[model samples]
Target chain A: MEIQYILEIIGTVVFAMSGALAASERDQEQDWFGAAFIGFVTAIGGGSLRDIMLGSYPLVWIQDVTLLYIIIGAVVLSGVFYKWLLKLRRTFLLFDTMGISIFTIVGMEKALSLGASPEIAAIMGMFSAVMGGVIRDILTNEVPVLFRQEVYASACLVGAAFYLGLDYLEVERNTNFISSVLLIACIRLIAVKYNLSLPKFNRQQRQP
Target chain B: MEIQYILEIIGTVVFAMSGALAASERDQEQDWFGAAFIGFVTAIGGGSLRDIMLGSYPLVWIQDVTLLYIIIGAVVLSGVFYKWLLKLRRTFLLFDTMGISIFTIVGMEKALSLGASPEIAAIMGMFSAVMGGVIRDILTNEVPVLFRQEVYASACLVGAAFYLGLDYLEVERNTNFISSVLLIACIRLIAVKYNLSLPKFNRQQRQP
Candidate 1:
């Protein structure tokens, strides 16, 4: 329970920071309201959607109102440290990878507990990890990171798959959680370090 | 129930057309798969989100699989008549307005039936009518209409308010639905005709 609590807080803050950074990058032309709203959406958007799809009631945030405050704090923190964060792009990206790695396990566990198939659970994990950025990019007027050549969804899927595999093998919960998170984070870090990406989709216009 | 079914079908077609047109306009470089997926998201995105938030199960589409076929049909129809639809921008916009109008009533009714307050019901109505376009714009990499100075959410709010008013007055259900839908459609048409728009949020860079 303590570890679960720690993971939740870490995931929440990191996702909030990622959202705030994303908003600052895109919404310099807008005000604090825009920035804060965008950050809020990015942090909770994916999990909220996943919860809804799974027919969970009152929403997770509604159950624990402090998450909203955490997101608000992240928005202000990003605003205050805008210059520093921009300089630490790689650092934040690492944090983002870690955050999403946590999200994948949390999301998958929630889905499985809800009686969803492992396949659906994996998709939900991916959704929970990436949907925030998807919504944020849409709000800021850009193609989502997942839709691009980034090894984004693939990382989440790999992590979710590993977690499911471990669960099937009767691995202890905390051990399974930590292993899956590390694997996802490691994969993501390697992908970024190598400038690795998925092949571009055959489309009408190549991404500039 | 018969009338509700008719409205659902009509709303589906209009939304599908709106989504298809939106995709063709913005994602032309993408292929049929892109367009179809975008259209599908736009048509069902809002109501689906609304349903999820309300803790409704199976989702509307899962409960009635026919909706998927209709969306597919709409995608194909839009693709075939891409040129013709392009030329009839006003007509398509009208259809979109109608789609949102119907969506407003349907969403509000659902929320109210779930024992939501009238105020919350109004918001659900607005969300159901507009979130589809919001998601579509995000996927296609554009700012949502609501975020900009569009009369979009306002029109839905007005329709939702009218619906609640009629309900409070104990008006017949069919009459209330019809009247609210007409009002929303008319408001949207007039807004477009007159180039009416909401004031931009006081921002660092106003939208040009």
Candidate 2:
């Protein structure tokens, strides 16, 4: 439990930094408040949506004020390290990938604990990993990268299915958790490294 | 209670139509499925967010399957009347205005019932009224019209405040409901007719 909590904290911090970086890089006119707001949303949006869908109360952040301060600190630190962070784009992507992996497992576990079906849990898990970026893209007035990017949500989904399958076989909890997270992270990294992407929907060729 | 239910149904239908129309008018390549999906999100996004925030269980649409069919019907009808709907833009705007007003009061009352504070309730009301459109704008890859448009959200806020004040003053519930909804509708219609809007935040003049 303690390890899970620490992992969640790390994921939240990384997500916050990514969000701040995204906002800062998007528009020259964006102010500190704008960056911070976007960062906060990007970090919390996915989990909040998952909790809401699962009918959980006193959202994770609301339950722990420490998480709020952590997010604030993360956002501010991102702002302070703005140029340095931008220069370390590869490192940032690594952390973002790790964050998504952690969030996916966390969300899937939470939904399962809430008695949600495996299918719903799997979908919610992917949503937990990706919806923040999706909301961030929406806020930034761009098509969600989830819809266009290489092997993001699908990676989460595949990892979730693996976890569920292992759990059904009575695998040890921590082993299942770590293995699933690693699987997602590896898939995302490989996809990005290889410049792999799903085929796009051919809008023009589709029957109208 | 029956009257409120009827009003909510009306609001849902109008919101669904607006969403479908928005999707259809935005991109020529948008297919029927795309338009319906966008419409469903736009119609349910605000209310679902509000319910989640308030820790309300069994989301409105989830509990009432009838609402699902209603939204689908509304979306399909909008597609069928696509050309006519565009031509009757003014009429559509009026319905949208009416939809916002009804959603505001309904959201505020629900928040109050869920034991939220007046301030949260008021803000949630505004959110319920405008968030669907905000989400729609986001999905459509536009800056939320809420941030740029006329006195739309502000009108909802004002009307929510009026409803709360009336409730405090022990006004009859039905009277308070009708009056607040009308107040919001009027304010919105007037704002649109006169092309009035709040002042924009001057990003350049501020300190970095």
The C-alpha lDDT values of all candidates are 0.82, 0.86
Report the lDDT tens digits of candidate 2 across residue range A1-208: 9999999999999988887777455544454545665677899889989988887887776556677678889987887777788789899889999999999999999999999999999999999999998988887777787877869999999999999999999999999999999999999999999998777656476576
Give model 2's docking category: incorrect
Q: What would the per-residue lDDT of candidate 1 be over residues A1-208, giving only the tens digit for each residue?
A: 7988788778888887776677445545444545665777788888998987887777777456678778888878877777688779888888888889999889989999999999999999999998988877767777788866488879999999999899899999999999999999998899888989776567586588
Q: After superposition, how far is residue B8 of candidate 1 from its true place, in Å?
A: 15
Q: Show the colliding residue pairs in model 1.
A: A138-B138, A204-B29
Distance (Å) between predicted and true CA of A133, model 2?
Answer: 1.1
The regions of model 1 sitting more than 4 angstroms off are: A26-28, A52-58, A147-149, A197-208, B1-48, B56-142, B150-208
Quick one: best lDDT, which candidate? 2
lDDT of 2 by residue, B1-208 (tens): 9999999999999988888888556655678887898889989999998887878878999999999999999988988888999889899889999999999999999988887767668868987988998888877877876645658888998899999999999999999999999999999999899997653211233355
DockQ of each: 0.19, 0.15
